[model samples]
Target: MREVFWQLVRFGITGGLATLLYAIVYWPIATYAQKTWPLANSATWPVAANLLGYLAAMLSGYVMHSKWSFRGHGRRDNLARTGGRFFLVSLVSLGMNTFFVWLLTGPMHGPTWWPLVPIVFFTPLITFGLNRLWVFA
Candidate 1:
């Protein structure tokens, strides 16, 4: 239980850092891509940007999570295998984020930020479980 608590704490910090990394990479490309590309709009471009961010964060987070967050429990030796698993999990998470954003903006006609609500609050929790139990396990 104590270990779980500590791990969560570490995950939060690592996730926070990853989130920052994500935003840094997301906004600029999103800003530019929207102008240059036809399909890229404020609503949808951000989703593509978020996917880029997701990929970057996944690489960064895997290193941190292995070395810092879940250091003691998991075998970090097989980075290729571990990273592949993590990427698979992230692929699902990304799909969910993209779908929700598209649904909110395209069909529901919800606020732009509405898509972010689930991406921010919900995705991490789910991914954390996947990372902890499966990816890093």
Candidate 2:
């Protein structure tokens, strides 16, 4: 129980850092793309920026989770297998984030920042579950 609690705490800290990084990369890029692009659909450019932000977060998140967050909680016998599973989990997160962005910005006609609600609150929970049960375990 204590270990799980500590793991969750560490995960939260690391995840928060990664989320900050994502926002730093995402907001500016989305703003710039929207300003520069001359597309009919405004959501398209922001979606691309979202992908770039996810990639940045995914890389740092994996390293932090593996090295600090999930340390001593799972096997480390095979880097290739662990990395592949981590990447898969990240893809799941990416899909969720992308869907939220699309739903908010495309059909709903919300601002780019609107997607951050789900991205910050919802997506982390799902990714944490997958990381704890499958990716790290």
Candidate 3:
């Protein structure tokens, strides 16, 4: 019980950091990509920005979750298996974030910040479950 509590705490801290990182990368790109890059289309900038942010968050999340958040909680002998599962879990997060972004920015014609609500609040919870139960288990 106590171990689980600490694990959750650590996971929250790491996940929060990753989420912040994602927002940092996401906001600027989503907001300015169209102006900075000639090829950056307004309609597609959200996707590109989200992808870049997800990549940054995913890489950092994997390391922090593996080394600290889930330390001593699962088998680490097989790097390939564990790493692959982590990547899969991250893809799930990415898909969720992308869908939310599309729903808001595409059809709803909402601002880029609108998708951050779900991406920051909802997606992390799902990814945390997958990472805890499957990737690190």
Identify the candidate with maximal lDDT.
3
Local lDDT at 90 for model 2: 95
* TM-score of decoy 2: 0.95
Kindly give the stretch of ten consecutive residues in candidate 2 with the minimal lDDT sum: 34-43
TM-score of each: 0.82, 0.95, 0.95
Quick one: how many clashes does candidate 3 have? 0
By TM-score, rank the candidates, best first.
3, 2, 1
- Candidate 2 local Cα displacement, residue 88, angstroms: 0.4
Off by over 4 Å in 3: none
Number of colliding residue pairs in model 1: 0
Candidate number with the higher lDDT (2 or 3): 3
Candidate structures ordered by lDDT, highest first:
3, 2, 1
What lDDT would each prediction earn against the true structure?
0.79, 0.91, 0.92
The worst-scoring run of ten residues by lDDT in candidate 3 lies at 32-41
Tens-place lDDT per residue, model 2, 1-75, is 999889989999999999999999988877777676656456577798899999999999999999999999989
